[model samples]
Target: MSRVCELTGKGPITGNNVSHANNRTRRRFLPNLNDVTLMSETLGRTVKLRISAAALRTVDHRGGLDGFMAKARESELSARALKIKKEIEKSLTAA
Candidate 1:
């Protein structure tokens, strides 16, 4: 997908790159994103998402991502995995 964090909604930023001659070129600052499968407790399934490294770190630091997902899966019969699956399908259709 795009160079964006789906969880945090972070995307590439525009900036300028300067040369020795003071000439400027367009530059893009992209977030560090990774495709990961997070367990969903509410749905008893896994949720795959493109998240930024920072977001992942935050989840890891909180020690609640997994637990929250599990709870979500258990609570939601139509789980987040299904949503992800649909979203992927929609993307595929557009492509």
Candidate 2:
């Protein structure tokens, strides 16, 4: 699987590891990702996604999967997430 956050679109970032001797070596700073299953209130089901810690916290702050998805941008979402977002929107609007 790719090292990317499905919810927030956070990916690996390149940086340098500097030694005490002033030697710099290239390194990757990857986002702290986790596999989580979030429940969608609108869809009334659980959905699993690979998301970053920050994104997981944001999901809580935003009030859950449905709320976060409502404000989430289309470009940042993966194919699976985008499909879930669409389902949420359709259900919400139909309700």
Candidate 3:
């Protein structure tokens, strides 16, 4: 899979690496991503996602996966995460 954060939609960024001799080279800054499996209480299942370390911390700070998704903006989420968010919302409404 691509080096992207599934929840935060963060991807590699291109930049120049400068040297002491005033030389520049192309370089990529990749996000700190981790493959994690978080449980969804409402859905009664565990969801696997590739997310940034910052996002994982945010999820924990927000109380859990569900809390984070509930407060997260749709535009900031990946397509897969958006789908999961929808399912989470549906489950919340159903319960």
Candidate 4:
């Protein structure tokens, strides 16, 4: 999968670069992505994902890294989760 936050659905953003000379240029604002191995309690396997720091924060804020991991491991993706994942992918690609 692409670099994204699976939990919070955070991704890269597009923007402009401003120069001291008053010139505007295109730039990509990338998210802070990290690779983490999530153990799937249901599947009984470890799955890898590239996600953003903010996304991780969401998981942490919700419970903690272990809680989120356990959720992913045991719980199947709900409609909301799939929708959010799709949005994150779209934003990352667009940026």
Best by lDDT: 2
Candidate topping TM-score: 2
**Residue lDDT tens for model 1, 1-95:** 45766555668999999999999999999888898987644345666777778877766765645433333333222334345545544554676
- Residue lDDT tens for model 3, 18-73: 99998999999999999999888777899999999999999999988899999999
lDDT of 2: 0.96
Local lDDT at 24 for model 2: 100
Lowest lDDT 10-residue stretch of candidate 4:
69-78
For candidate 1, the C-alpha RMSD (Å) to the true structure equals: 9.9
Native-structure RMSD, model 4: 10.8
- After superposition, the stretches of candidate 1 with alpha carbons farther than 4 Å from their true spots are 66-95
What is the Cα-based lDDT of residue 68 in candidate 2? 97
Query: What is the TM-score of each predicted model, taking all chains together?
Result: 0.61, 0.98, 0.92, 0.54
What residue pairs are clashing in model 2? none
Across 1-95, the per-residue lDDT of candidate 4 in tens digits comes to 55456555566788999999989999988778887765533334455566677666666565744446444522334444554444444554676
TM-score quality measure for candidate 2: 0.98
Residue 10, model 2: lDDT of 90
By lDDT, the candidates rank as 2, 3, 1, 4
Per-candidate clashes come to 12, 0, 0, 0
Q: Locate the minimum summed-lDDT window of 10 residues in model 1.
A: 68-77
Q: How many Å off is the CA of 5 in candidate 2?
A: 0.4
TM-score of 4: 0.54
lDDT of 2 by residue, 15-82 (tens): 99999999999999999999999999889899999999999999999999999999999999999999
Model 2 stretches with alpha carbons more than 4 Å out: none
